[model samples]
Target: MNMSDILANKVVVVTGASSGIGRAIAIRAAEHGARAVIVSDVTEAPREGGEPTAAVIEALGVTARFVKADVSKRTDNDALVAAAEDLGGVDVFVANAGITLRTDGADVPEEDYRRLMSVNLDGPLFGAQAAARSMKAKGKAGSIVLMASMGGLVGAGITVAYSTSKGGVVLMAKSLADALGPDGIRVNAVAPGTIDTELLRTAAGIAEASEGFRKRTPLRRLGQPSEIGDAVAYLGSDLSSYVTGHALTVDGGLLAVI
Candidate 1:
């Protein structure tokens, strides 16, 4: 199949797509020929400043619909799926909405922790629930991609809450894959390392990763949002039909040494 036809005729729903990694995933999926791209997020504005995700995807000659959704809310997630059904039953759902704190593990506040978990942990859970139900109802074999982080695999003292939430996501993929496998719904995750997004820049207290931090990776550089987008595209496409319950790490080999 041609590269662009990998997801031809598919309808993809991506949360947190107003900016950062989620935006890239939506755009990449459209570039790969998704029939419709459901761009869902809490708001329509991009945090990094650019055209809305739906507009960008539409410019690529793909159908795009903007759905304002908070993945942490079950109703919102269900509504997102409903919007996808208007085009066609969801073929892939990318639960990429998440957040992190700038504090180290020990000093996180209670309110901060709760808010973080709601967005990071509960968001994907609700998204998976809504997407799975839609896919099963439509009798379509669909893919679910959760966003995980490098800290999920290894203990990161700096971002403990974020890591803890993503660890749950990693296991969530495995558990969901087992439960949904018989129904032909595949579940997977993509764990990224220090991608150069506005979120990372704000969290790291800089415009980009420190040169010392960059050198620590085997690739000797930070990852890009588009690189994570590519990995997610693989999981959402027929290229990874047999792949499920797997966490594809796209950290520029940062996990190799650490």
Candidate 2:
């Protein structure tokens, strides 16, 4: 069977689908033939693939819906699972919601640190819990992919709490993989390096020379949101049935510290 159709008839939910990696994953997941595509995020504005994402999925002749909710809230996470169940239950979940700290060491305010932790750390934890519960109760196999960062695996110059939160997500996926494996649920993570997403452009300190910095990588280029989308599709699809508890780096060899 074609890999594009690996997710055929499967229902998937993607958090932070308003833009960046989450939006790309949603679109690619629909392209992969997921029967139902549910997108969730805190914002209501026109994201790159907001209505367009739903439209594309519906064009593929599948079901698609967008929900506005703050992923940091436990109730909101439960609501996402509820929406999936309302649409017929979930087979895959992409916890792509995250935020970056705009300030460096001393400039990073304590309140900002707390806000970032709420969304980047607590959000994914609650998401994994909700998705795992839904999948476990279904008595069938499922997949959960969380968004980590190259910083999570190592460390960045000024990531501070952002790195810490992603580090938490990376370990969370591993722990979940170990805990939910016997139940047929596979958990994994995607750690992106420098990508040409709007988020990267607006990220705390790495915006100005992102393109130049991307070129300095061994690959002589930066990655793209679409690349991460493809990776998410793999983890979310049956194609990766045997892959779990691993953080697949999608950077252009930026993590290759030789």
Candidate 3:
């Protein structure tokens, strides 16, 4: 039950970790005694406008490295994992980088759709592939967690591309789990709903949607970034040894009702 027991000595790599849910995940993993936490993102600055994630983690006296990576590219993802391997083999990889645009199915532009697929879908796919390869090469057992969304589970009127990409991520996790199980590599996805983060605040019509999300949720409030971080930590730890190919929903009971 101690924080150190959860991820003690583990090497964790998290993409899109400069802010929001990803930043929280990196911080929590370090707090749980991860030996090395590699933060891979396009920038070091926090999107919500505060201290950089690496600085905060270093301030905690944890070994943290910030590697600039654009998750949309497979080469970038590969390099990101390589950076983590330099410290130690990656014991846990969280494919958390993603982007969302507010547009209906009919109004979605070709360029926008491609960008969504590249970042939201292909990012996890390539990241998992690279991480799995590294773990297998090192003859190590590892865990891979993909960031999914409630939109992937249900149809949302305004997020056509985003929903589709996330839906792909959900199933991709399952497929990867099946493929990597033989290598003792576990794969899973976390579907978060309405977490109060910079990403959600900047989403189109979030103000209007926030009230609806609160009213529909049994918890009557938005989930916090750290809540999602806790879920990732659990999935990455031995506590979830028997769990894989599953989409853990942390939605404040919103999905339970629907």
Best by lDDT: 3
Model 3, position 25: C-alpha lDDT score? 97
Candidate 3 lDDT by residue in tens digits, 95-201 = 99998877647589998899889999989999999999999999888999999999889876688888899999999999999999999999999999989997787
Clash tally, candidates in order? 0, 1, 0
* lDDT of every predicted structure (CA atoms): 0.89, 0.84, 0.90
Which candidate, 2 or 3, would have the higher TM-score against the true structure? 3
- Expressed as tens digits, the lDDT of each residue in 1-258 for candidate 2 is 224787888899999986877877887887777889998888734344345566656776778898887989999999988898976688999899988876845457899889999999899889989998999888869999999988888866688788888999999999989999999999999999888887777776778868766767898887888899889888988889999999999998877854
User: How accurate locally is residue 217 in candidate 2, as Cα lDDT from 0 to 100?
Assistant: 86
TM-score of every prediction relative to native: 0.95, 0.93, 0.97
- Model 1 TM: 0.95
lDDT of model number 3:
0.90
**Rank order (by TM-score, best first):** 3, 1, 2
What tens-digit string does per-residue lDDT give for candidate 1 at 74-105? Answer: 89999999998778789999999988776548
Q: How do all the candidates rank in terms of lDDT, highest first?
A: 3, 1, 2
